[model samples]
Target: MSVCVKGDTILYGSDNYLKIADAADPSNPIEIGETSVPGDIYSITVRNEYAYLADIFNGLRIIDISDPSHPTEVGHYNNIYYTRQIVVRDNYAYVACEGEGLKIINISNPMKPLEEGSYETPGRAYSVALKGNYAYLAATNSGIRVIDISDPSDPFEAGYYPTEGYAYDLTIQGFYLFVAEGAAGLRIFNISNPLNIKQIGYYDTDGLASGISVEGNHAFVNDGIDSLFLIFDVSEVYFPQETGCYKTATANWSSAVNGELAFVASDGAGLYILDCSLAPTLLQSFNIRQAETKMELSWDISSREGITGFKIYRTTNEEQPMTKTTSPTIPITASNHYEYTDNDLINGKSYTYTLAVRDSDGSESVIGERTVTYKLPNIVYLCQNRPNPFNPSTSIECTLAEPAHLNLSVYDINGKLVKT
Candidate 1:
């Protein structure tokens, strides 16, 4: 039910044993080790010389994994009722102990793990991911609960996302938190500032997503209900597009990704090694910059070998289709800045730009259609004092294009300085 990767070493739990493999050659993963442990392993995390395992009933089982060929148990902390997932950082082991909430275990002494603190989660905790001073928990019906672990010995709740579906498992990449929602598919949230979290996007896999892993711009999600593994392009955080999928024999409960290879855990069918290099590396960024009367479109991408170049397309109205503004003109083989300056645009008029790729055979194919508008920068306008001929107090109004703070000073009719 759990899987983790450390360098080229891949470990997955099957029944009551942990299976280890060498995935240097992703196409043919070779088993290297196996270790038996009491209780079912729900999650696994490795750091340094130890592999921390969260057991459903056995609490935390710390295994010595310095040797990938033979992993051995070195410590255990079995006082909790249930431990579903664990995250080890520095000297602490953060355990999602089901109804018992999140337990902070000090593993500075791995052999004698001690409970340092605990946070009462709002719901049944399923998974936990750590970032900086916060620990994010996937609390089933309660959504994602952020626990401030800055003071591990005295953890407290910082915020919550209130997930849309059954939050199962979660992982953190950069400042974004990716959650595997059982029925709601995959949920993505921006945790740049942990306290002020916002949902950025979500992809409905059309099945129960029990586990997920993200690599680069791709997200590998496992669907347990429909026996499928889905991959999505999350380069655009607001709109995650499903670019690939693989159907398994049985239910795929959990999965992990290492570069171009994906390791999946199939309930009864065993581990699945898949080649994920087929997923295309796409445009990393596309932006629009506006000048007085023209807009400059800039974009850059990876793997420019098989492509000819880029073709710029434009449209002024949504009802009207986009037309190619120029031929295939941006050579990307050795250039870093690929841009096109579209001129003669009218002020205050909004135009949308679409980016397409001209294939080798002179055929234009849409890589992905996206819109960026630097339409017009806002201008600050100060309206004449309202109710000009007012009595003691008059209303003054001002408009700003964006949010900002400013000071206003009032002067008397005789040109005398007044209150501000």
Candidate 2:
């Protein structure tokens, strides 16, 4: 069985049913809906209002989840060998069919999914990830196979990286690829050059590494055998070091992260939600607002022991290094709120802001991050209404350069005041 999270909903695959659960409170997941499939569902991927299921022998099953409480099957595609995992991109669904390799199916038409191409690998394809025009497949015994998917109708193998252990799962962040190598532990590879993928570093865990998810500077890995959740510092892409680990009673199948929470799916423990935040717990909300010429950031914090102060970092290019915009000695008090306005920003430019707290002992930890794009100056610009022809309702947009209390009224074709 497998699980995928989208927003506040968790799509779980088990037996022959696809269950949808409300994850507002990840710890206490409440099943809201379920739909039976033709075969045992092993994996799932959710996009928009549809949930794509990898049903072993049944191939791909598409279910409409527009109404989470009442899901309905919309389409199905058979003839693929034991589909294990799936990753949907654009209008195509990439399936990791065990023994059958990679099967690319065009999903532009939800009612009819067609097989656009297939690439048979040496080993069973268990998981897949797409980057650029290449498809990275974690083939059980065959390791990682890099296939050029520029031509979806005719995909060809570009390269292969033979791993020491069973490559169960893999995720890519930037130029680095983190692999969960069963008994081999967590393996980090530099995929800057997919053709020459190099294993730069690895951390041998106490148990079998079954799944992994990376966020910011940390990598969350589940050790299936030892039933432990391991956290590693991946700030240095080449050399990863374990920072902390939590012991779980049941084997953790996989993990996904949203904000400060790490959701772990276990074999028997159901779902476990962990507080993966740094020190100085965020009490209220972290907000970003744009003014005429500046951007304002405000957040509330609940103090913790050993906390010194807080620091802020800003960057225009996420790929490049961020600059420290605030001093490390910034004052902080228990149950206090703070606000900062940055005027040194260019209009229409995007910027990322990060908040970190430091301890008296000089140890610093990142608490959270937010990205915002400054809006360009617009002096009374009105856009045409959408769905111009005729519809029950349409949307009209307007922009103003400065704040003003101006009235906007909409009239019918006969100059009748319809809305204001």
Candidate 3:
């Protein structure tokens, strides 16, 4: 189980199947696309419009992820088996092939990846990470091995660090190499000098650490044995402290963030997406009812947990910015229903109304928008003719909504000269 995040889309692998999920609403994960692979997916790395996967029996497979919902395989390299993990940098992919060591393939052309180089490590390669001119391999029992890939066609090892436990995964930040040492937990190594790398600090998660991901000063580690996910503060490398943790059914993958979304691949449990924004889901809907020269707008909120109120915006044309229609703001209430009546709209004209939810943190997001044309029926009224049956004179009155030329002709009461 592994995951790769790009923008609001996530490419996660579950056994032999790969899928794309939409994380626009971090609270709920929605699958947008999927495809089947030949082998169990071990690792995934994305670049441009394609995703590179290390398919155990399939070697290396390049998938076109431009269309998340319908991802398709574009190319493959099946020379070696047990392809554990892969890392793509520039025009080449560095793959960790268990017994085959490290294999470099030039992917300048995504459809035809050509083998360019190879380096055999003393241990079985399970994972790989990249830096300037070095490639770090998480060689299960043999630990971390640094390979220099400056010469793609002829790569060589530059350093090696032996860990106490099985090294399942690894990541690099600055001069530090963070390794997920199976039973040994999270291990940190200082590799300023590739040839003289040394262990600086480590954290025992009390379980099996199989996957890890680092961003900024925090590291997210997944334990396969206890199904535990841990967050560490690595600001002080010597003492990486645990800040938070979430338990799943069987966590075996890592994390990558899009905005405030954190993704993890848990065995049996599938993919779990966390919304760090702590925003409520907009469950209710916004509706507009058209009336003569006016509009009746109503909307509902699922909950007002972190919400301060709501704001309504109005516009005649989308080319122009909408103006706020709500006064002050619609304050949160015990009731979920919110209604507002907008009057004095031009007849036979369209108007757009947008509803935005404002949070207590001052962040606001548009929930819904709708456009409607206002119209009114045509009608005219006429007063009763005065002095009925009078021979001398009679008074008449007529009223119409719009201005128009009127033609009047006085004639005997024989329904003459008056056209309907």
Candidate 4:
């Protein structure tokens, strides 16, 4: 079984039925509708008003989900290979056809999904992720194959990375790609140079890594055999470490993320929703306050246990990288609260701060984030011109705490307004 969340609805595939449930309350999913299919549904991807299903032997089936309670089949394409996974992006649907490899279908018209192109890989294509014009495919034993989908009619392989274990699934974030390599665990690759994809780091998970989902600086993966859902801190792309693990009853196949909640799919145990908002423990209250030109951060920990200390990170741009601002705090057995101040920050710039707690075993987990903007002084001040003697040009500066409209006039020695 597989599931995908869209808006307030959770679309899932079970046996030969495509079930649609209202996920207003993710804890208790209410099945509102279901559509029957000829073949067993392996994966489903919903985009806009359509739900694209990867029907095992029946191939791709597009259903019109404009009305949640009454879904009607719009289009379909039967193929020879078993379609295991499907991902819809823009006007294209990338299908991971088990033995047939990657199949690209044009879905510009919901009533008619035509085959655009396909690329055959050595092993079974289990999953796919499309970024820009390239399609990253996880071909079971063949590892990861990067295909240029720039030309949908003729998709060609651009690069390949062979893994020791079966590459079950993958997800991309920024310049890094996270792959769930069966028993080999979660493999992190630097895709900045897609042609030269290199493995930077890896975390040996306890069980078979079947699926993965990335949110912010964390990656949630499922261990199929152990029925465990694992969370890793991927903030340091080159050094991913496991932070938390949740055990389920059955085989955990895949995971989907929405906000702080992780929707997991377990083969026979059914669906499970996990609260991944914060670390398992160790964090109490984390806050930030602005004092004049500096920003102060304070956090409290309820339990120390095997924890070593905490590390603080700051970033100016959300898209840009983050930097560690302070050294790791010294672990104290009695202290519960700690404080740090970021001094001499440029005024009018926004900053984001994250606090991570480290364990005695060298593993770290991000606890919280605080975003604050530094403002100018409360009173306006105009500085004197840099050069006393006039040259062609001199720098003039002024500061304002609040928004304002002001006009500056420049006068010559004659006292006549020359420039404004």
The C-alpha RMSD in Å for every predicted model, in order, reads 12.8, 17.7, 19.1, 11.6
In terms of lDDT, model 2 sits at 0.83
lDDT of 4 by residue, 1-420 (tens): 788888778887778888888988877889999999998888888888888888989999999999999988989988639888888887889999888889999889878788999999889999999888888999988999999999999999999998888999998888888999999999999888889889987888878999998998788998989999999876556557566889988888877888888888888777888889764434557789886556888888657777888888888874468864576574555778888888757778888887777778898766667788888667876878888666788877765666689798888899999889
Q: Write the per-residue lDDT of candidate 1 for residues 191-307, one digit (tens) a residue.
A: 988988999888777889988889998988989999999988887776676768999999887887877888888888888888888886566778887764467777877657557
Global CA lDDT computed for model 3: 0.82
| Candidate 2: count of backbone clashes, pairs at least 3 residues apart or interchain | 0
Clashing residue pairs, backbone N/CA/C < 3 A, model 3? 33-69
**After superposing candidate 2, which stretches have Cα over 4 Å from the reference?**
278-420
lDDT of 3 by residue, 1-420 (tens): 888898878898887888898877766768999998998988888998999988988899999988888899999999976998888888999999998899999999988999999999988898898888889999999989899988999999987887899999999999999999999999999888887889987888899898888876677788888888788767556657665778887655666656555687787778887654443335356788965445899987656677899888888874487764788888988888888888756556688887777889998756667788876567655657887877876777664446677765666488676532
RMSD of 4: 11.6
Instruction: Give me the runs in candidate 4 sitting further than 4 Å from their true place.
Output: 280-303, 308-420
Error of 1 at 253 (Å): 1.7
Could you tell me every candidate's TM-score relative to the true structure? Answer: 0.74, 0.66, 0.64, 0.71
Best by TM-score: 1
Which pairs clash inside model 1?
Answer: none
Among all windows of 10 consecutive residues in model 2, the one with the lowest summed lDDT is: 277-286
